[model samples]
Target chain A: MIKFSINKAFFLQALNATKRAISSKNAIPILSSLKIEVNSQSITLTGSNGQISIENTISAKEENAGLLVTSSGAILLEANFFINIVSSLPDITLDFEEIDQHQVVLNSGKSEITLKGKDVEQYPRLQEVGTNNPLILETKLLKTIISETAFAASTQESRPILTGIHLVLTNHKEFKAVATDSHRMSQRKLTLDHSSDNFDVVIPSRSLREFAAVFTDDIESVEVFFSSSQILFRSEYISFYTRLLEGNYPDTDRLLVNNFETEVVFNTNALRYAMERAHLISNATQNGTVKLEVINNQVTAHVNSPEVGKVNEELDTESLSGNDLTISFNPTYLIEALKALKSETVTIRFISPIRPFTLIPSDDNENFIQLITPVRTN
Target chain B: MIKFSINKAFFLQALNATKRAISSKNAIPILSSLKIEVNSQSITLTGSNGQISIENTISAKEENAGLLVTSSGAILLEANFFINIVSSLPDITLDFEEIDQHQVVLNSGKSEITLKGKDVEQYPRLQEVGTNNPLILETKLLKTIISETAFAASTQESRPILTGIHLVLTNHKEFKAVATDSHRMSQRKLTLDHSSDNFDVVIPSRSLREFAAVFTDDIESVEVFFSSSQILFRSEYISFYTRLLEGNYPDTDRLLVNNFETEVVFNTNALRYAMERAHLISNATQNGTVKLEVINNQVTAHVNSPEVGKVNEELDTESLSGNDLTISFNPTYLIEALKALKSETVTIRFISPIRPFTLIPSDDNENFIQLITPVRTN
Candidate 1:
């Protein structure tokens, strides 16, 4: 039997980290259990699938002196319930002991629970990535890039390649992230201090979403390791691994424009409010189009649905350049882009009636661009 | 053309109350619009179906010096979009004028909007209730009574009467609210200062829900006007009307037990936590039974689901009276009852295997009582 005591605070942190390790719907029963083992100085928790495994360890303390280990053993417990109980328990030493080959005792203060366990040998093995192949980037910057561009990725299962954000590192100094659903596109650019040989990868948006949850603002750098089909992100004490999406991304450089026939700048808040109002009725229709009419110095947004009626609003613009233009686009695309914008004023450029429009921050300091294709309105 | 200037704040508030007046999915187009009319002292907004209508009036203010009313007329504007636009606009004096027979102009500061309006004659008329048969109750007390008991009402549409709480005046000064779903039940009693003739009314849960949203603690008494088929709750500024659910309510007094075979008393916190843990897995099962085994000074809660797993928790009880009993009940009902409990300790009384169980505050306050029927486990 294996018996040991763990510091409640340290154990909770490690347990929460490994909690994400277990799959909610694992086909194999053994893969769902976390393998916990006690060494002299630390306790290791391993949760794994056949492809990916996460291992976390918490150091033991002096107050846990009486902790004894009769034999080294492994057990598997239900992930969801065990985490719920441990998180709610008061800060106190936790006792873990193996009563039999398949049973383990978990006790803290007045609470004692006995749960069935699985054999440790059934746990999947973790892949080893050489330290020489790691690339480092600021954690906050990485989080910002993911937040800005991931929402534009296609959620439909038909286009599996569009579900991944294409990341390209130019000479290891500048990084770019791009996501598109064919109709709408978003891109974010940032500069990195480290230089690794040139690299390119397509990480699934779902995995980046999970990484965003675990990332905090304080961490300075995150080490990224990539193998053929899997990528791992390592922060200070946590490592997140996800399977990479496989396919060739479409070439999108031809979709961008260098010049525009008309450019209109307006406060983000005003445009957002106008689109929100238009969406109120347009949302009932199939395409949900909102028409924007920009003349010399004014812009009017018009939304009409045969079933719900119509709404037309005139908004003050900061400035307008070039010839007059009329464009109709999906209001949802504009709303999402406005929600992600960080600047007070945004400049939208229109090239032609059939071409896509480009939305960029009015201030030149921000390196983000969002492009939206205009829908043909009847 | 109808023209008026009103305070945006007052307009937004009145608009909110009026928006709720329209039916969510009404067949008549004008029934889904709010009828607005400008008079000398106030702007009245009426939203109605054929049976019910909410009329809210915002009195003119000193700022009305600039406000102009050219003509007194009524127009119907789409409730959803109009409310959203009015709320998002900056707080300022708003100018509303009819541009044509079918369009209206809404302008405030630099923002101008033209919305298509429907003919007001198509809107449904508000039902008038006689003021003679009105019952008075404290607004706060009524809100509390509804919140506590309404959640237990049956959500199934088969028994329409069960979807409403039965409100009956036992004496001139005492009122009772009772709701049940056959399996679980909740009842609350309140004392009134003024005496009224004996009365009973069944108000739909939906109307009570709307009142809960708008009711505040500052108001003292709300006058309730009852007709043959509709009930109206009148506050100082707002009148709420709801269609009564037809059919006779079940007699639940006999379901209450006068004595118990065994009573188990325990701290509310301990039992609540145990039940919550058990509920995590029990929620997945059909009947979701959580068995309670009480012996000596201990209570054990056992919840099991063949597909997910099981949870067993032992709780220390203050004391147990009479014969030892093992009872199974829905943990969700028990959890909700415990949350509504006012006392720190709760005493549960058991009568028989298939009979209802009583859960009362340890203190001998008869104002609140909750009964839950036990589900037989195989």
Candidate 2:
């Protein structure tokens, strides 16, 4: 049994953070309970699954001396319901005491609840990945790279390697992340101020996404550690870990081309608006095609479905410099690319009618590249 | 061919409003299209289903008018895709011309395409609901009443009459709305400065909800007209009609008791927070019972489920003037009642453990009352 008094606001935040560490599956009942231990100066909470675990400690002012050691024990309680009650309780003092061999009493003010708990010995321990020289990078830059490239990872289970983003760190300050679904690809580059030896690893996109969601508070830097088969991200208070996919990523550098015969520059907002309109009709069909016709000085968007008719709109263009080209591609790709772009105007370069096109920022300073392969239309 | 040009923003808003007038079913294809008719000074767009129809006209400037009447005709175009394309186009002059017997060319600069059009004569005519001396009420007030009372209406189809909220207007410048689903009930009252003859009507909650969504611009008053089987809400720019559900609504007046044996007052926020926590566990069970125990000066919420465990919370109360009572009711009902309250404190009146209880604003000047029936718990 553990008893402690904690600041209500601070405790609520810490509980929320710890709750995300537990999984909902009851396959391992002990894994769902939050382990609480009180010391002289602070209370510590540890939540873990077999693969990953998060430990959070909040410091408190002690009113009694010698740690007050009323009880120092661990009990497994239901996670979902426990988090809800803790966040709603009005009082800051949480009285936790064991009632029977397996039942625990939790009291806050006039409210009292008895919950069944599992033994601490059944809970799995978290494995530590050797962090001899963890690479440190800005948290915001890492988050940006993950968001931009993670969406392109293949969601299919047939190819397990394609579901994870390939990360390669050159020296200590420069890194590249790439994700692809075979048909389309996205890549981003980030430069860090810290230095380390060159390292290469692949982390599952799902785990990376979950980490980004839980780390809402902005931090200056994050330390990344990797073992032979796993990766870990360590911040100030939480460490996120995931198993790495075992396979060699396909060579994709040769696929990107710098040459282009046709190029069109337009406002990202205008292009997005046009594509949104076309999507309304094309979305009903399986292929969802939107055709772009570019001539000497103008461009037109034509969206058609034999069953639902067609829509044509001439969107204003900034400039068009290239041979007259009519290209048809999936509109969904263009919409997503435009959404990721930060600049007002975007320049799209096309190699040929059948080749993949590149979407780059018009300002030419950002080192981001998004490529989309066009679908062949008969 | 019907050809005209109007402000794209103005046109888009009118189209969006009229699109809601179209029915999803294709029983009559013409009903899915907006009929555009060009006159000397204005262009009228009409979209209709058998039950409801909306017509909006946009006046053209003197210079914009060529009476360009090469041909006066009507055509039926698909509503969904047309509205999307028109709204997305950049703010520019739109030229519409008929290319052939069944095709219309819509061009704005280089973006031009010919779309197939259906004969306008195939469209269904709008049904006219006769009106007598219609009553006028503030739009904001009506919207508030609908939002506060509509959620309590029965969603089940077995009791058709319970799916609508009963609205009664009295000559004493007062309007009342009531809704119930047998388990819970909500009632709201508003006083109007304008006098009108007493009228009672039942309007479908869904229709009122849709009407409220389309009413973006606030107006001083809205004219309401009632027919034998239909009710019409006429704003300055749009007229919405809904068919009344046919049946005799159960008399709920007798269910409300003026006096109670015990009354308890608590902060709305505190009670709401406690109920939300209790619901976290009770929601897992079918009965969804949350036991409320009001004693000397405290109220405790207890929710127990053998399958998912139990939760108990003792909530602080401002005052408890009623005799000790233990009652169990659906926590969802109380949640909805708390949401409808506008005051900081709410007063709950109880007469018996099994009878319906009343929750009203702690302040005597507020005129909203909610009733919830207690479930029999063994």
Candidate 3:
């Protein structure tokens, strides 16, 4: 039997941390529940979808004054059902007691909920990556790296390895994240003060996305342990682990071009707004394709649909140079990459109308670059 | 050639009003475009999806300082593309000019968009509902009547007429809106200050809902003219029309009971919360079924799923009387009814465990009543 009391806010956080790993529909019945264990000084919750497991702990420390345990035991409760119940209860603290084989009774003020649970003995045993000295990463920086590159990863079922972002660390001083979906690719690099071993890993973009959401802007750092088969990310309150995707990432270093025949710079917001408006027309009539025409010092975007008619608008550009060119690409791709660039002004470099081009921040110090393959139009 | 300039806000409102009637995908290509006509004092915009047509007018009245039209001509431009272009432009006012054969150029600040348009002569003419003397209704009051009853209408495609609300007026003094999906029903009645002719019409709930939303709350009244096949709703700025259902509505007045065997009153908010929580558990396991047991002045909602286990919660009630009752019904039905009632306290009248019941405001109200049939449980 296990009994404890916890503040509503703390309990909600524990549930949210464990929720991401629970599969919406599971073949194994035991995997549908989140296993919760209460010990002398802490309450731990674990949930898994076979490949990815997440565990969160609320310890009985000064910082966690909301938690207090009277006895120690373990039980498994349906993840979504239990979360819904606790979320709806209105009170500062809730009392939890297990009784009658595998039944959980929760009480808060005048609200009492009795939920039938499963035996913890049947729950799956989750293995964690060894706790050897791990690489420490700034939480805020890591989150930015993932968000800036994750969406460019392919979701196609054909190539499983392309679904993750390729992460590379050299001398522990520089961090790089890269992803590509064949047509477009986004890459961001950051140089840190300290050094680290030269290592390479491909983390599933979906898992990184979920992990990033768990940290706040104030979180200082997260300890990462990378084993041959799995990776562990440990923070002050949560531990997350996921199986490493097998297969080598494509060598994309050669894709980055340092020199170009032509380059045009424009205010990020101005270009993004004009592209979105053009996208509005293309998305409805064509396959989200828009053409850009660069003149002396101006660029105009044009989209013509045979049935719905045509639309063309001039975009304000800071400067245009090199060979005057007209290029066509998916407006959505550039919009997303520009968003990740996170700059006031952006520069697009082109070699030819048929060749791929690179987009980078106008400030050379920003080590982020996005590449797009222009669509061939008649 | 036609040219006009209007404040961006005024242009946006006119587009939104007519845009609702334009189908997402229309078989007739011209239906995808919104017809714009600039007259001496006002600009009129119209869009139609065959069955429903909406027309909005922005006149040069003192109140409409946002509009200033210099030419009088009509042209048709793709609705979605034009709206998208106009929305993305930045400035207080936007200038519109027809150039070439059928090209419309829109300019705002430094942004200019040239969109191709179709000949206005090919656009289909919208028919209007005839009128002798139309019934006038307060914009606010009509909106309330539609919202209170629309959701109860049947959405099943088998019976087209059941998808409408039967609106009736006796001598224009009393107004009633009623809708039923066979299993559940909602009705609201109000006594008008002015008189109207005895009129009965079954208006599609969707059309009434759309028409009601187009009016501003401050509008004093809307002149409604009902024809044999269509209904016209005319306001100060918008004119709307929709087709009427041909079938007669079922007699639902007899379903309401004047007295009750057992009446239980509960705080609306408290009851709603408990029901939503219970619904969360039952929605996944069962067919959204929940059982209510009323005994000894307490009401307990219980849901049991052999596979997912069981959950039961007690809802606080103010007063209980008549007899002991164990009833089963979809919690969603009562929740929606209570929302429509919009009252502090609610009273649920029960005839028996298996019979239908009526839900009303705790304060005696003959103006509004909702009926829900109990589900049979083994």
Candidate 4:
């Protein structure tokens, strides 16, 4: 028999954390529901699609914790139904009890709901990543890095490995992440405080997003475990797993250049907002081109569509040097890269109008670099 | 020449109101833009999609009124581009100047944008509903009646006239609005404060929504005019016109019946919330089926899907009377109708399990009656 009075907050958190594993249209029948194992001290909920699995636990502790399990048992509930019902319940203590091991009932105040359940025997077993010591990392830094670079990954299947965020740990101290879709690329690097074996792995960008979403604000640290076939992330309240991409990642070190023919410096907000106005007319069929004309002390943005008319914005710049250059590019790529920048001002270096340009945050941003190829307007 | 210094708020309101008449993918080139005419007292803006035309004029009055046109002239500006640029400008005064008869410039603070213009001579003129005195109706009441009945109209085109809301004025005082899609029907009536001659017409539901959107909170009454081909709604700031449906509407007086074999009275919110929970498992293929079982003093909502499992809940009721009847329905139909009800307590009267039911608001509901046919669950 299983019975418990769980606080609404904890139950809702666990349900939402595990929901990323439940797809709207799960092709696998067994993957459409979640498994809940109840015990005297705590309760564990696990949800999984074929590619990833997430397990969350609510412990009985603190002055007034969210859960209290009296008896121990296990059962399966349809994920979508369980999520909707729990979300719509009143904001108070909720009582959950199992009857005959095949059904469940929930009650709060004047409302009581009974839902049919399935035995946990049919739930597929999750693979274990072994209990040996795993590499520990700060959850906040990892989450930030993922947000900075994962968006640059290729969404097309032509090059499967390019769809993953490649992580490289050199001599167990220097950790770097790189993502590219051939046209534009973003990379961020950091020095890990804890030492470990040298490792390189490419995790699919889609899985990284789901893994990152389950991190709570209170979860400062996470233990990372690695197998030949998959990567696992274990935290105090949650465990996440993701499939590894097969094949070698391209070496992007050669693409990072330190020299330039012309360089322009401008406040990130000023340039970004100006581009947005120019973007009103710079849509895709028109090549999404926004021309930047660097002359004297200003950089003017010009966008002209044959059908929609023209837009011109002269943006204020700090300094414009070297051979005056006029270049164009898809404004969307530069806008996103600039938005990810952490500095108030940014330096953009160009090598003629045909070669790719590099964006560097003024002395403030620590270890991230972005590059974009200019679209030829001439 | 048209030269004016206008504030951003007034300009935004006029642009958005007219945008509703401009389709995103209009085949006609002229229909994609808005016509702006400037005068000393007011500025007029017009947008039309051929099917519907909306004219909004901003007058100089009251504190911080929307417009103060300085000169007299007219031109057409691309709706999407103009709206986007004006919306992004800072909250301050903006200057508009016509130049060379074929171009216009907008200047605000440090930004100046030049856009090409079209001559008003080529613009299509809207058909006038004549200068004869039009009927006056309370904007709130008309909006309320439309909301209650328009949703029941058929969205499909098999029967063109059923997609309209039929309005009838009997004895020059009582006005009734009725809409039906064969499966369900809704009717609402009220006595006009200002008496008029007998009138009846069917207006397409799509056009009624656009006409209602132009109403402002301060405007209590709107003058309505009718022509053989169109209906016109004129307020202090806006004028809206729409084409009338060209067919005779079905007479629905015989469908309204009195007396019933079973009836249930409960708070509208209580039943609506319970049905929403039951909806998690109810959907169209299963007929969007949710069964309501009425007992001595309780009503239980039950939904069972073989693939997704079952859900059952007992709802609180004020009173349950007559023979016990178990009726099932497409919860969406009943939910929408109940949401439109204005009273706290709602009484549902049923003739039989297979017959249609009438929904009447307890005490506060005025002049509105909704009907829904129960789906036979075999």
Query: After superposition, which runs of candidate 3 have C-alpha atoms over 4 Å from their true positions?
Result: A26-30, A62-65, A90-92, A109-112, A282-289, B26-30, B62-66, B90-92, B99-101, B109-112, B121-124, B218-220, B282-289
lDDT of 3 by residue, B1-378 (tens): 778888887788779879999976999988998999888888889999887898998887836446767777989888987887788886778899988888888888766667788889999988767766878888888888888899999989799989999989886688889999988999998888878777889998989878776777877899888888888989887889888899888999889768778998999888887777767667766567888898887888887766655567777889889988889888888778877877899988999977899988878578888899989887
Per lDDT, what order, best first? 3, 4, 1, 2
- TM-scores of all models? 0.87, 0.87, 0.92, 0.90
Candidate 4 per-residue lDDT over residues A165-276, each given as its tens digit: 9998898899999999988999998898888777799999999988778886689999999888788999987899888899999999999888898988889987787777
* Candidate 3: residue pairs that collide: A171-A196, A172-A195, A172-A196, B172-B196
DockQ of 2: 0.39
lDDT of 2 by residue, A199-254 (tens): 77877787777777766657677788888877878877666777788889988788
Ranking by TM-score: 3, 4, 1, 2
Predicted chain A of candidate 4: TM-score: 0.94
Every model: iRMSD:
3.6, 3.3, 2.9, 2.8
Clashing pairs in 2: A172-A196
Q: DockQ for candidate 1, please give it.
A: 0.29
- Residue-level lDDT tens digits of model 4 in B68-96: 66778999988888899887654377888
Q: Which residue pairs does candidate 1 place in steric collision?
A: none
TM (chain A) per model: 0.91, 0.90, 0.95, 0.94
| lDDT measured at residue A159 in model 2 versus the true structure, 0 to 100 | 93
- The candidate 1 chain A region of ten consecutive residues with least summed lDDT is A61-70
Error of 4 at A165 (Å): 2.0
On a 0 to 100 scale, what is the lDDT of residue B23 in model 2?
74
What is the full ranking by DockQ, best candidate first? Answer: 3, 4, 2, 1
lDDT (Cα, tens digit) per residue for candidate 3, span A203-312: 88888888887666666999889888788989987898988788999998889867788888989988887788777777766566898888776778888766555567
